[model samples]
Target: MDISTALLTFLHILIPIYWLGGDLGAFYGSTFMTDPKRSVAERMMALKILNNIDMAPRTALILAFPTGLALAWAKGWVQIPGEWVALAAVACLAWLGLAWKVHLDHGGGGGAKRLDIWIRYAMLVGLAVAGIAGLKGAIAVPLFIGIKLCILAACIALGLLVRRALVPLFGAIRTMATTGPTPETDATIIQVNEGARVLVLMIWALVLAASFLGIATPV
Candidate 1:
């Protein structure tokens, strides 16, 4: 491979590393955040740490698409226009900025978060379509690549589902922080986390499946 291609390949490999590693860290943090024995202040501190660690996977997710696309182009797997590839990279960077804003802004970055959600929704639709079409031979792409796209779509969908499931958990945590934990809030936190844990596991599986596709490229 050429140097640029080699570099892109290296970067693509790093994405799943950060994605999975960061997710494990955040998952670990959630335990501390939800532990009833911990002080409220300590739990809140855990939540902060979780949010910060989550940025790694968030960043890896944003970069994955463009990096994969660039690698495909470099390998002659596809013939996308340079301008379009550049545009995709730029858009991913903007999405990365918005993602950080949503995380870092204590105000919640409501509008930005909404925009980010819509973008993910759009991506989910697009990836699903492309993957299905490619698999059906309607699009000119290899089977493993098409499967990778579908895997990516599933991961994104599960991510949104996790976010949705955790909304009530966040609200409960906030209520606990201000008003102190009650049985009801504690129940909500545990219940929500339990549900989200399943979704997170599914995401982990999909990420592994994507990695396998990239490496094996089965016919």
Candidate 2:
């Protein structure tokens, strides 16, 4: 392939990485940092990294569709249907929730942890449907189906894991404001949360491997 073609390929995949990778890292990494054994300084560093993880993926997720749609059309994937295009629009709305939370957190208002959780699941549904349906077509595309399954599985795992961590955020009105971390409450839950996130990354690694094996395009 020519340099420009290769560049297009890179851009195609890179956008999803930014969107999926960044958010997953941030959400799951925070749970890992909650261990009492870690010094406060370490916790602070983890928090900083978690913020990057949670937020950086937005850069790619936000741009990928508009750009990907153009690329898909150029590659003659199919003509755009209004309903599928509506899914893309809902994806943007889901992303806007994250952006709202980010803006609030940055501006010194309390963060929308609950809202983030809501949007997380919402986006998961959006992405999962898009990826799966993109592959499960009237005519089969084996490689595309494989790639979509990997991504969808990773997303489903991520949603499950983050949902595990979300309980504390949901209960903030009652307990989280003053309660200390117990062995049962904080540390162990985080371990499970992190483990779930690790699963997401593992699946994602598989997705990338498949992509390299020409999974994104049909034979």
Best lDDT among the predictions, by candidate number: 1
Tens digits of lDDT, candidate 1, 78-194: 667888889999999999998888887853868998999999999999989999998998978788888888988898999999988988987898799999998898889889988
Which parts of model 1 are misplaced by more than 4 Å?
A: none
Residue pairs clashing, model 1 = none
> Would you give me the overall lDDT of model 2?
0.56
TM-score, structure 1 vs. true: 0.96
lDDT of 1 at 150: 91
Q: Can you list the residue pairs that collide in candidate 2?
A: 18-57, 19-57, 22-53, 26-54
lDDT of 2 by residue, 15-134 (tens): 666765676677667664666676545655775687566555545545545455444544545466646656765766566666656654752433566555465566566656656765
Best by TM-score: 1
Candidates' C-alpha lDDT: 0.88, 0.56
Clashes of 2: 4
